[model samples]
Target: MAQRADISVTWERWQATPDGQTARLFHLTNRRGTRLTVSDWGATLTSFKLAMPNDNLRQLVLGCDTLEDYLQSPYLGATVGRYANRIRGAKFSVDGQQYKLIANEGENCLHGGEIGFAHQLWDAEIIESIPAVRFTLHSPDGDEGFPGNAIVTVTYTLSEDNNIRIDYEATVDKACPFNLTNHSYFNLDGVAGDVGNHVAQINANQYLPVDSESLPDGSPVSVEQTAFDFRTAKAFNQDWRKIVSDQRYRGFDHCFILDQNDGSQPVAQVRSGDEQVVLSLYTTSPAVQLYTGQYLEGTRGHNELVYQNRDGFCLETQYMPDQPNSDCAEECIVRPERPFKHSTTFAFHC
Candidate 1:
């Protein structure tokens, strides 16, 4: 019989919030030397490192060195919530009543308004039984223009097999549009370098096209003969110029409809440029946003690294973007009777 992997978790006071509250950082480690550092400040993941065969540590996720840096960074490894992506026109109607949201990105509400969950301080505790850390937040009714007093919890668990499981659960007192996802920019190369050479495959046959505002323009379309095709393993730069010219975007910044949204298998796999490390993503969400760090060209990251374009990629699994204004709005609406729950896992192989 295979032995069970031993796991452990620890926490330390990292910094103080602007509100004078103490924010803590939790470390979840496994016997295999895989370590994940998360902070309660935003329920954000600061770092994920794997122990390579050469006794060297390989960092997979892009992050900042300090809490202040994270506050300024673009999501980084933070948890995005209320709504993962954008909501059209910064408004949505529920039960014959129209609600308006704060518009942070053009006329759309991006990532649940300006003060989304990513900027909130959460209460965190270590769950010894499952060897995980649970971060919880309470969002009052009308917060961010969402009509609900919601209690949300995000738990991160590390397993012996080098899988980091993220479980999200939320309950709302009233009907509201709810969606959450982790915006972790991954580069299996262990450094925030160009991921154009990294081989990747996404289990999505259809993709959503976005307009100049990065919002869904129309219905989903086939990716068979387009630059968005990643049905098979290929380097990100395989159709780099084609994507730039055809899509009119700097790089990949689109949503893909997963062929299988059941979370039974990995929906995406990315290999390191050196072909030494691999990351497999499994999620219960229906779609995954593929963003190739186009705007991160001059951003500074951990270790004083100045990130260039396509330095890392994010596979954010969640409901379709602008779903609240689309035909599938019901899929994201959380009622008092029906709560919100989802799980996403990132497995590292070296």
Candidate 2:
């Protein structure tokens, strides 16, 4: 069995960090009996348990059992920001001024910096009216070498219809790169099996190709005849090994430009092999990055399960990777005058 959930919508102190701050957890339940657990540590969605048709509950996302496990985990269920994906060569020019960022992934930066918003402690509030946890963080100017004081807010709300909605809003004092997204690895079959048989359909006709280093090639390419095509529903592992067999490539790390997106319609849909559950992803963002967790190597997870490669998959809805360097059509810059607002929802159903 997976970790039991607290049915009561209560906020409790989960752990006391050595740094003197407290990590809190807020448990939320919807009218349909779906439960969601969020942590204040990174504004992370720790657990998303859906009530199965068989009258049982199943944990749908990959998460850690403890705060310690989350500290060691690689961006699992965390709200990553300042910037979400790669920044290209650890540098980008904003308003004719070139800024150098911390390089955490080889010579390139990945998910903010060496110490990103992912590991930061956020101020949490449980809104009684909506049954949501609102997390706010203030990033001072020059934090992680970024050139602006950014005030960011992320809210996790569990709707009565079993949709896990994430609302992100941010404002920066100066023009800077601001792409925020949740990095939650989802496996509809719980954490017991791989996601090979998971059926996925993405509403995208083109995808952003990448270079050898996994940086965007500054343009978009058609997904036709390529394994990157998920425009139609198909088994996830179908032709997966043949696509990523070279070992130099991680599976499905490319970004798919959402088709006919106006932020209201779902951009992608995924289902378990047994057809027991279906997850619909709706986002305001123009693109969704599909990563198959090709490098998921860890010893600990829910139920003490050792997570292996391809055990989970991430549907990170965001602008695009290396936004500043790429020629993506969407605007990735957020400034004081023009704030950034984006929302993503994962609607789960059986």
C-alpha TM-scores of all predictions = 0.96, 0.94
Q: Model 1 — TM-score against the truth?
A: 0.96
Task: Kindly list the per-residue Cα lDDT of model 2 for residues 1-350, writing each as its tens digit.
Answer: 33223323678888876487889989898656788999989889989889887768899989888788888887899999888989888899877798999999999999999889998899988776665789999999988889888999999888777888899999988998888999999999986567879999999999998887888876888889998888889988786766655753336777999886677788899999889999999998889999888777773788788788778899998888888765542399887899999899999989
Query: Candidate 1: where are CA atoms >4 Å away?
Result: 1-5, 245-249
Error of 1 at 153 (Å): 0.5
Q: Estimate, for each residue in 97-120, the C-alpha lDDT of model 1 and write its tens digit.
A: 899998888888988899999999
**List of clashing residue pairs for candidate 1:** none
Worst 10 residues of 1 by lDDT: 241-250
- Candidate number achieving the greatest TM-score relative to the actual structure: 1
